[model samples]
Target: MTFHTHHHEQVAEELYDIFESSFDEIFVTDAHGTVIMVNSACEQYYGLSKSDFVGKHVRELEEQGIFYPSASLQVIESKQALEIVQKTDKSRYLHVRARPIFYKNGKLKSVISYSRDLTDLMELSHQVDKMEQQIEFYKRELVQTQSDITGIIVHSDKMKKVFQFIERVSVVDTTILILGETGVGKSRIARLMHDRSSRKTKPYYEVNCAALPETLIEAELFGYEGGAFTGGLKQGKKGLIEKANCGTLFLDEVGELSLSAQSKLLHVLQEKKVRPIGGTKEIKLDIRIVAATNQPLEEMVKKGTFRRDLYYRLNVIPLYIPPLRERREEIIPLVHHFLTVFNERYNRNVEFSPKVFEAFLKGEWPGNIREIENMVERLVVTSERIVTIRDVPFLQQETYTSAHLSLHQKLEELECRLIQEAYEEFGSSYKVAEELGISQSSAIRKIQKYTRGIE
Candidate 1:
């Protein structure tokens, strides 16, 4: 009996020593929820000495506001282990786990509580949340920038091909010529090319050849020295070409340039140098040229109205954008896009009726994408929440005519118009089929039907 008592005492001393050396705040409480023991770590973390808590009821410490809602008291009441978050008077956060010790008879004997400091972990969590919010904000800003910078919307195969070609040619430094009718987004394509090119970070200069008079076109393109021409700036302003150094210069409506202007532009292209009018020295240029024209340059070259050398120089890379009627698939998507834009601008939520959509799809959009966008904006501002067919006055006559015609006849008319326009643009059944989103045989049959009487 004496030897057994000595061994038990030795084991108890070892356990106490282990408890004293622990890093976490540890407290042992008796069955009545009175704190019987506390480790030295409790004093360092809770700002209290062991004597401050020893032999005190758990409820007493909580009432004194040393710490709130004692974990050891919770374990005594629930008679089970629990983990909880607690706050100390010193404004520190602690994660505490309390385990209830039970006798063999299932009666609670005592409770041992362990607490770890949680201030660093909570601060780290807040930092991560802030970073995630910042990332989301940047993402939204990037999307808005892309939308504002490049409003080009491509959904049809025809426009998709144009974008693919732009992507391929953007990396290379060469002159590009865009051919299309007015308002077919030719200038937009020019801007897109510049945005995608290596000189994207530099200035993008645009000159509308047709917008300026013949007399001013030369001075606008090639800077004139002070006193070179009447009413010119005394300081001799830099021209578009010089302003666009190390960047891109877009010449819109290039076919409108006079013979003298054309010759000067050609010289610039050949020598990569421009001489200011009445200036003795030539300014060397490091610029890329992108020209757009609605006129047929080839026919003009044959007519001797446009210079052949300049034509070849500008036509190095030819990109033609078909009219909206030819690529009908893009009409509805473009309509929705413009609708969204206008709705936001006017702070309205207007919606289109089913019949309105049908009229827009079937009507001849002569001005192409620009016309559709304008009409949508007009309707968004002028019409109510629901835009019906009656809102579009221009389509009323066409709709009445279609109402009288048989279904087959109406479809034939639409098909004939599509085939004729596609053939004119593509010049081949295979290409027409690809552009119109139809089979080659169908395109050929329609083309032959539509062109039978003409040729």
Candidate 2:
């Protein structure tokens, strides 16, 4: 053969090799959308042999499960390049793109497609959606937490004293016990301490001792290693103590911790170390423990339900929070605060009626500040226009009718009510000390002193 003919043949063969070995799935089709060419990945994706696909119509092969051909239709219809996604029953998701190929006279000739599978990307999208939902859920929780305390009006001197106590003790790491009637913002005060303290920037882990069963509580406070038991994460988990390292741990309803749990917790407080469940290694923590309860812990120790030694350890800094009733002066400000917050959340312009304020000042609020917050949220969620006395829930309307008495007698009565109520609410004098706003050990001594006075 002539050298010229041989040279031409060699160039053509190299071009063919490049087309065949390319990573892209390149197909040339006539105006009618026929498969003129394909590459290796295309062959694997559609389970097709070269000869079988060579002369086949692109759409027909897609129908016969040979290759995806929808991109060709898009290219034809739009007269432009566009991206499309495809899914197969047994395979993952895919992203397909199509572009029209034009002839020299500005007439349409055929379509070319470029594509990639997107199954993993779709999975990543799903994970992103779940994360967004979780963020929204936590945002709602934070709003509710803020609202719960906003309901307790705090104009009273006693509550101001509690606030002052919190301010004074915030910089110290002394274990603080919060004493108050149920719903009187003991947990909020605990948070205030953490927020104000040197540990404000660290994780603030909260535990509700009564919310979970004893078996789960240990694992929650100190994470367990995988195989610690059936269904435990394969790799052991970090305990809350570890999470609270260089942070603060808030123990709510601490009076409810079982004797076993209390002993373990006391060890943590004394030595600043925690040993996780099913794990031998002990983790050291730089944490501040804020224990709160509506209970009478000293009484519990007297009854032998709680340990006295643990109480003494936790009562290093005693801060008391008075009930909403004693702090009647705080009612208006708290109500306004909640009203403004809920108004924005519920999308309304709401204002309290004068009578509602009157009812608030007079009510006993056995459920304390929490009840007021819940009521405010309810009104915002369900009511329309400016809220009035009539719009307030049934229980709130009845608060003004419960009592009439002398000022000093009333103060004494409220104080006694708080003491008895706290004792019943928490069942231990130590808890009473904390929630009623005193040291656990002091709560013990106060109960002893008071009971003797009544006798």
Candidate 3:
């Protein structure tokens, strides 16, 4: 327990040298798994210095809930080795493997665990999940915007949370249901959830249940064996469920599935087994089910347009992605992200004039990220530089002020609207003015003049 012993010091020095070189934490724990020696790397990893971790229990510093104490304890008492996730106050997921040491008499002495922080991986998984949701959202928005599908953008906190939700669920093996409006990105979230899960490295197969012919739905999902059904492949075809083995299967518009398909899909999900069309034996496949729908499934189930049992099965982790209108705060970022994307695609640098962004905030992005992406793409293809609000035909033609107001008093109402919006958006006069393409002093004067009556 002293600072050093000559023999242990020599060995500890070598270990410290190794620890200093390592990016991960490496510390020595005593027989009780309490910190006996701390390395600089270990300290830095835990946001502490050597002096602080000298006496703390290693397990206490990690998330005990993530581990099975009995299994971890066995590694120390029986000289076993085990790997697990370590959750701590500072970090959520750390890849740790504990290796135990034994005496000549076969008695266990102490255990050493190498722990690597993987919070970034979890975050990355989350990002992939987010993008997945965004992409799907963009797809629906693409159709809704009546804008170009090649161009899509998402900039909304609501959409970002959708992404975060997808990321959180990527690693989990469970059935996920994505719900939103017609133009919302449910399918994209499904792909995202798949790409970030344990199955990310595997294939992602997608099919739209609504689009498939009702008669062929079963064959497409479960595949048919040669001679099993008339006109079936001679060699037999692998179903979408089978094709998604060890990966993710995205069933879009699940609400549209026929009762037969729903029954089959539900069985596949529950049993983790698939049957080929006309095949006698059921085949097992490793699959993650990601289902999506724009329909109000619960309402439909109540009305008997959709199945109640299938609804419950797919709703294990229900993700309700809010529409673009809710997260207007993300409009600018989404615009920029889309602008950059289109700029690269078309080799054009399209700049947004002050009015364009103002117009963006004013306009409703019901199509969500997809609509923005299309508009940005249009700018890329049609215009070159200084893409102004006028360049957007929608902005030029659309009515900005409330439609209920008469034209005569609308200007005064519009001025009030702009000032109020700027104040709320910027939280300060200077920021609003910058966004509004005005001087801070002018912005202050305007606010002073306009609010004088109310104040």
Candidate 4:
């Protein structure tokens, strides 16, 4: 071989070695944007061999979605250097920069596109975003917890876990379903989540679905345009959803919504837009939804009363508040909280007697926090400085003798009364057992069984 020809062939070999050994993906396309060569890294990135890409037109590969917005094609068209981000069909992100090579005559020779895999970086960015959201949520929660008026009382471990979960999810703009009995403070939980969320400054409206009449529920939720109905306002009326834009909408007693209303609500949730009962144009919304229900929604779904799709949408995050009888540790703290609240509200310094506290500890608060608040207010308003056990209306009515009971019934009543008194006197199951001469497990079992029936 001639000396100059051998020297040029050696240079080409070195260049080819460098191109094939690169960790990044490298594609060399002709002036017409046809793939002439691709590095082996393409196989790792797109799960396709180099042969699959080579000899294919850039436009054809882009149409096939191998990697969208082919950088080589853009460089070919513009005849200049281009940098762009592309997503492959395998869902991998690629950061690409393509530069067109030119001949001495200023004619395009080839395009060399270099791509670095950014899928891991993109995933890490998403994780960082989630962590930042959690940090923001905790900052709000810290302020809320340190404030004097913390609205709700939490003493039981069960409640503590629930609050922790709320703190984590409050920042996420997902639907939350608060599940509990009538007065276990489901609405309070919902409000707490909204207060800790990003939309706290915006309007937070609570709509009691059960309180709204079935006939007007639709119109109330999705407002009516002018002349849409016989009794409609002359100007178009904004619904609760529209009013709660960029905020939160708490749907209390959500299970009471009719099936038709449920379907419309589902559509709004899915589409993020709502059309009024008589409106032709749809109103867009940016709102978070928190729903509460005492009813068993899953059972309602099985019965075909509740829409299954709607139930799934609302139940994305379910927070269940246990009954007062189950978490009796909260009872005394709640009573103290209510006492302080009512005393300040009524301008009365009424104190509960030891026996009154005992009665409260032993009683089953089927009506939950609402009942406690009412009872404290009643005592603060009506009682003397010291509210005695006899002052409690429920306890006063429970004064009964076992004279009309059978032997089994009498023993059962005596067992229940003794357990209640012991539990009231000694708070913990172990302490109650120490006082009542029973096993600790038995004390716990008896407390669970009898506390609900004590009053």
Pairs in clash, predicted candidate 1: none
Kindly report which residue pairs in candidate 4 clash with one another: none
Number of backbone clashes in candidate 1 = 0
Identify the superior model by TM-score, candidate 2 or candidate 3: 2
Clash numbers, per candidate: 0, 28, 15, 0
Candidate 1, residues 1-455: lDDT per residue as tens digits?
99999999999999999999997889899998898999998997778889999989876675455774467876777787976656666656566778999999999999999987755544454455446547646644433332232135565799899889999998888999999988788887887798788898787888999999999999999998999988999988788998998999999999999999999999999999998888989999999999999999999999999999999999999999988888876665567667766787789998765346556777788888778888898999999787755578876535323678898888877777666545533446678889988898887677656743221
Candidate 2 weakest lDDT stretch, 10 residues: 446-455
Off by over 4 Å in 2: 1-154, 393-455
Model 2, span 395-421: residue lDDT tens: 232232246766776665556656644
Q: After superposition, how far is residue 216 of candidate 3 from its true place, in Å?
A: 4.0
lDDT of 1 at 98: 86
Q: What is the C-alpha RMSD of each candidate to the true structure, in Å?
A: 27.0, 30.7, 19.6, 28.5
Q: Which stretches of candidate 1 lie over 4 Å from their true place?
A: 1-150, 398-455
* Rank ordering of all candidates by TM-score, starting from the highest: 4, 1, 2, 3
Q: Whole-model Cα lDDT per candidate?
A: 0.78, 0.68, 0.66, 0.79
**Residues 232-326 of candidate 4: C-alpha lDDT, one tens digit per residue:** 78996889998999999999999999999999999989999999988889988999999999999999999999999999999998989899898
Better-scoring candidate (lDDT), 2 or 4: 4
Model 3, runs deviating above 4 Å: 1-164, 228-232, 397-455
Compute the lDDT for candidate 3. 0.66
